[model samples]
Target: MDFKDYYVGLGVSPDADEKTIKKAYQKLAKKYHPDVNPGDKVAEEKFKEATEAYQAISDPEKRRKYDELRQDYQHWQKRGGRGDYNWDRWQTNPGRGGSGSQGHTMSPEDFAEMFGGAGRTGGFGGFGGEGYSDFFSTLFGGGGGQGRGFSGGSTVGRGRAGQDTEVDVQVSLEETFNGTTRLIRTGEKQIEAKIPKGVRTGSKVRLTGQGGPGIAGGPGGNLYLNITVSPHVHFVREGDDLRAKQPLDFYQAIFGGEVSVRTFDGEVLLKIPPRSQSGKKFRLKGKGMPNIERPDQRGDLFIELSIILPDDLSEQELSTLQELANKRG
Candidate 1:
C-alpha cells in the first residue's frame, strides 16, 4: 500500500509534459502488450501497470491532483508520519458491510460500471483503459464508496493486433534473373511466395495478414521475407550490371570471328574484331540483371576477353610461326 509514483512508473521526470508521458506509455505498452507476449502473466501485469500510469498522467487535471497527493505523501513521510497515515483505504475489506470496516469489496462488473462512461478509450495509444488498477480507481472517485476496488482480476478485453513476423528467404542469382516461386514454411502452413525478377540480396517482400494470429478478434499482422541471393558460379553482380570473363583462342584474337558468349538468358554470338588483343573488354547492352521495380528494364553485361594459346603445337605449326616472326622482324 505504498504511494504509487505515476511519473516514475511512466519513466518520466516530475516536470515531464503530456507528450513525453504519452510517448513513454506507448513504448512500454507495445513491449508488454498481451498480444505480443501471449500467455505471459508477467507481461500482462506490466501492461496493466503502464496503462494505469498513463491514465493518471495523460490528463492535466489528473496529473495536477496526483502531483499534489504525491507531494503531501512525501512530506508526511519526511516528518516520520508514514506509520500514522491510514494505509487501510488502499486495501479491500472482504466483509459485505462491517460496521466500522474501511474499503469495499468490488467485483469486476461493479468496477466496470463505475468508469463505464468516463471516456476511457482515449489518450494512450489503443492499449485501452479496460483493466485499470484499484489504485487508479480510488484516485478518480470510482473507489466504490469507501473501500477501493482492489479486485485481483481485471475487466479489460484481450483485443490486440497480432505481431509482425520476419523470415529470411534464400534465392539463387539465376532465380533472381528469371523470377521464380518458392514454397516457404511459416508456422504450420507452407506458403508459395513469388520472387519478382531482379530481386537482389537484402530485398524484402511483405505478405499481408500472414503474421502471428491476433487475439480477441483483433486484425492479424503482416509477414516480411528478407531475400538472400546466392552467388553465381560464373558471373558476378555489380549493382544492376553483371560481369564475366569469356575465354577466346589465340587465333580468334588475331583473326576476328564469331565467338559464343554465355549469359543468364542464354548463349549469344559475339563478333571478335580483327587484331583484338588479350584482355579486351566488350559491353553487351540489356543483358544484365533486371531492375527490381522496373522489371522490363535491364542493365548491361560486361565481358572481359581471356586469350588462350594452343596447349601443343605441331612441327608444321611451329615452322609457320617462326616464318611469321622472321617476316615481322
Candidate 2:
C-alpha cells in the first residue's frame, strides 16, 4: 500500500497542534458524515479516510511516532528504496505476533470476538466491503485487531462516544407556522421529533443519544434533524417575515373598498385607497411566521395587491372601461 500522509490528507502541518488537528477533522467530519450524506459512497469513503487520519494524528504519541516513520520513509525513498515497505514495525503491539500484510486466517467467531462483528469479513465495524486500509488497520488498532471497533468500522479504545449524525427534513410552510412533529428513523429505531414553531430552512433540531452506536459500552451520540421549509403556493418566507400576493377586484381598488386577505393568522381586512394600482404593497404587523427562538414574537407580513378585471363584462361596461382607459391615456 502507498504511504498515507495524514497531514496532507487533513490539510495540516506535520507540526500542527492537537487542537488544530481536531478542528480540521471536525470540519471534514461535519461535511462528509454518513448520516448527513446518506447513500453517497464517495462521501462515506472520504469520511472513513479522514477518520483514519485523525486517529493517527490526533494523539500526541501516535503523531510523534508517525512523524518519525514518515521521515524514515522519505529518506528511504531518497536512497532508491523500491515499493517494498516494512509495515510490521509500525504495527500496533508488534510483539503480539500480528502478521502485517502476510495474511492471517481469522474464523468468523474470532473476527467477531476481536471487532465485535461491526464490519463484514476482512473489514471493520459498521462499514462494509474492505473499510480501513490494511496499512491503517495494521499501524493503528483498526482491522484485524483484538480491539473494539466504532462506527465506520474503526477500532478504538473503550468509552468513546458514538458519532453524531444529521438527517435532512423538509416541512411544509404550514408546518413551519405551527409547531410540527415527525417520526424519524435512525437505523432500526423510530423516533418522533418535535420541530419547534417558526423553523425555516437550515433550522436544526437535536436529539441526544440518537446517533451512531457508542464504542465498547460507551454512550450513544446525538441525532440532528435539519429543517428545510417547503415551498407554498401563495406564501414566500423571508426570515420570519412572509410575502404574498392578495387578489382584489378592479372596482374595489379603483373605488376604495375593504378587502379580506388570507394570511397565516387567517383572514385580515385591508382597506384599499381610491385609484389603487396593481402591485400595491401593504404590511400587516404580527401576521407572519412565528419566531422559533422567541415564541412570543412574530414577523410582519407584506401583501402585494394583484388586481383582477371582470371577465364577464357587459357591452356598455366594456365601452365605459374603454372610455376610461382612453381618458387616462
Candidate 3:
C-alpha cells in the first residue's frame, strides 16, 4: 500500500490541538461517511483516509512518533536525498524502530511485538492473527483468541462512554436582563448553575464530570443545559434588543405626553414627542440582556407605540367632535 498523508487529508495542521482535530474529523466524517454515501467510491476512499488520519492524530504517542518521522523525512530531503528513503533498515534495528512504526503490513513476530504476547496463542483462536482479532474485537467484540470474551456469550465486556442528558430551564426576561443563578434537579442530583445574562434559546451550558458514571473507572462525560427564555407579558426580544408595545390614547399619539412604560427590570417614564404616530419606537440603550461573559455591557430595548381608541362615545362627545371639525374647516 502507498504511504498516505492522513493529516493533510483531514485538513489539520500537524500541531493542531485535539479539539481542532476532532472538529475537523467530525466534519469530514459526516461529509464522506460510507453509510451516508453508499456505492460512492470517492466517498469511501475519503472516509478511509479520514478515519486513518483521526486514528493517528487522536493517539498522543502515535502522533508524536509520526511528527518525528515527518521531521526526519524533511531533514533527509534537505540533504540532497530523495524524500522516499527506505525504512526497512530502521524497522529491523531495535531502539531505532521508532515505536515499531509499521507501514500497513506485519509479520508474525511483528504482530506479537505490536500487540501483547497473545497473538501467538494458536493463531488467536484459529482466527489467523492479532490484526484480525483487534479489528473484529473493535467491530463485533469477538475473536480475541478467548471465546469467553466474544460478544455472543463472551466474558470480556465492551467498554463505551455513557450517554449525555439534556435539560431546559426557563427564566424571566428580567432575570435574563441581568443574569441569574438557579438550582436544577437532574435525576437525584441537584446542581447549581449560573445562567448568563444574554442566554437565548438553544444556548448550551456544559458541566463537565457531572454526566453518567464512567465505566471501568474512566472519567464521566458531561451535562449540557439548554436555555429557554420565558416570555414577559409586556417585553419581547429581537436579536440583542428588547421590544414592547405600549398602549396610548389618541391624545398621546396626536400630542406628546409622558407615559409610564414597563421594562424588564422596572417601570420607566418615557417621554413621547408631539405628533407621535402608531408603531413609533423608542430605544433604551444598555437595557437588554446583559452580556454573559462581560456583565458590564448590555443590549438595547425598543418600545413600540400602540394607539387605543374609545369604543363608547356619547351624543355630546360626537357633537363636540363634529363642531371642532366644522370650526377647523
lDDT tens digits by residue: candidate 2, 1-329: 67899999899998899888878976886677666678898997887777778777877676787898899788768746754765534555232222222222234464345435433232224464454455565565444333333333323343445777899999999998989899999999999999989888987776767888876565577788998888999998898899999888978888999988898778878988999999989999999999876767999999999999879989999999899999999
Q: lDDT for model 1, on a 0 to 1 scale? A: 0.69
For candidate 2, the per-residue lDDT at 310 reads 79
Instruction: Please write out the lDDT profile of model 1 over residues 124-151, one tens digit for every residue.
Output: 2333323344455545433322332322
- Clashes per candidate (backbone, < 3 Å): 2, 4, 1
State model 2's lDDT. Answer: 0.73
List of clashing residue pairs for candidate 1: 103-147, 104-147
Candidate 2: minimum summed lDDT over ten consecutive residues — where?
96-105
Q: Give one digit per residue, the lDDT tens place, for model 3 in 1-329.
A: 13345578789887789988978976886677545676887885565456556666677866776676567656656645534564321121111111212222223464355333433321112212222223222222233334322112323333333445677778777777777887877777888987777777767766665667555544455677888887778777776777888899887888899999876667899999999988999888887767654557777988889999877878998899899999999
Q: Which ten residues in a row have the lowest lDDT in candidate 1?
A: 93-102
Supply the TM-score for candidate 3: 0.51
TM-score of 2: 0.52
lDDT of each: 0.69, 0.73, 0.61
Give the runs in model 2 whose Cα sits over 4 Å from its true position. Answer: 1-158, 325-329
